[model samples]
Target: MKIRVNNDASYIRVFNATANSDKIDVYINDVLVFSDVRYREFVPYTPTFPGDYTVKVYECGNSEKLILEQELTIAGGNVGTLVITGIMPKLMLLAVFEDPNEKTCESNAKFRIAHLSPTTEPIDLTVNGVKMIDEIPFGKRTNYAEVPIGVYDFTIEESNVESEERNDGIRISKKIELKDNKIYTIYLIGDVPDIEIIQSLDIITYMNK
Candidate 1:
């Protein structure tokens, strides 16, 4: 008789947060993973082996002009994101670990925010005039905030940029409607006065043996 053992794989997604319009190319361990990825966009997650790997980023069709590189580690049965954030000449990398085994909620929605602008100052996140996340620095992420299903106004302001007596620090504002039983990831991209906030729905499904 013969027996075999199998190991589960980890999953990773990419978020492009640069101000440049050049398409991006992402490589993992010398193998091409994502190609021609656009700025201010999020790519769907792809499966990978659980271990350490060399991650590299370059301008599409111009691999000679490499942009960013980092050594990323993935744990078995976990989910994560590889974020290419900040402006050129000072771009940065941030990895986020999401729980793969998290169950879907039926009555509420969960969301998280990531600050990726290298040139922009720290930020404060507010929803419906109420401060939600404060003093978020570049390459940092806020914990998931749960909210009831509904629509609300979302705003991001530059922290300490203006006096506390005024709201002149406002950077960007938008309206978002949350659906029940869903998860979301929002990314803040680009340089000051020209920023973009992109949102993506996150779907988690485990592979069966």
Candidate 2:
């Protein structure tokens, strides 16, 4: 859908996190905005005038069967993500927002985590042995935290699990590099015992248009 550029514009993107859903299409205010989005896929940020909007989701090529309908508000000059989550027959939408204008230290990178896995338990995120976020539940996200630029091991484990039992509780462990002055979000998606992560570099400049 074409939206007129204006000073009060807001930017939004869609992520398909539904583990058991078919490829889908998304409509905002009855206008087709994202189409044929498959599982684990993301639609790039699109601009829209800030206001209340009615969002509808339907299986791709079959709009007659509505999957979900929701109402959401978009504030001016902000960036956000709309995540389609949960398994079939019990789906939902999650809205996560970020302020591009939020100030941060230039020498460090800003990082956050989003828990989108429908079947996973609450999690704790540790980077290089330091706990960055503790006990974050599903369908929630953490506020940005500043970290010194460097490569580090990122680990996600079940919250409240003992270190000795980590072998069974650990969900993901991987190395990721943080670049100076960059903004990032690590999203934990999919169902438990089969969870996956998607790291995103948030570019604030792109939201201005």
lDDT of each: 0.75, 0.83
Candidate 2 stretches greater than 4 Å from native: 1-7, 205-209
- lDDT (10s digit) by residue, model 2, range 1-209: 22233459777899899988889999989988889999999899887688898999999988797999999888786577899998887889998877666445666787889999978889999889888789999889999888788898999888967888877774798788888777787899887678887888775523332
Q: Write down the lDDT that model 1 would get.
A: 0.75
* Top-TM-score candidate index: 2
**What TM-score does structure 2 among the candidates reach?**
0.89
lDDT of 2 at 162: 84
Prediction-by-prediction clash tally = 0, 0
TM-score for every candidate vs. truth? 0.87, 0.89
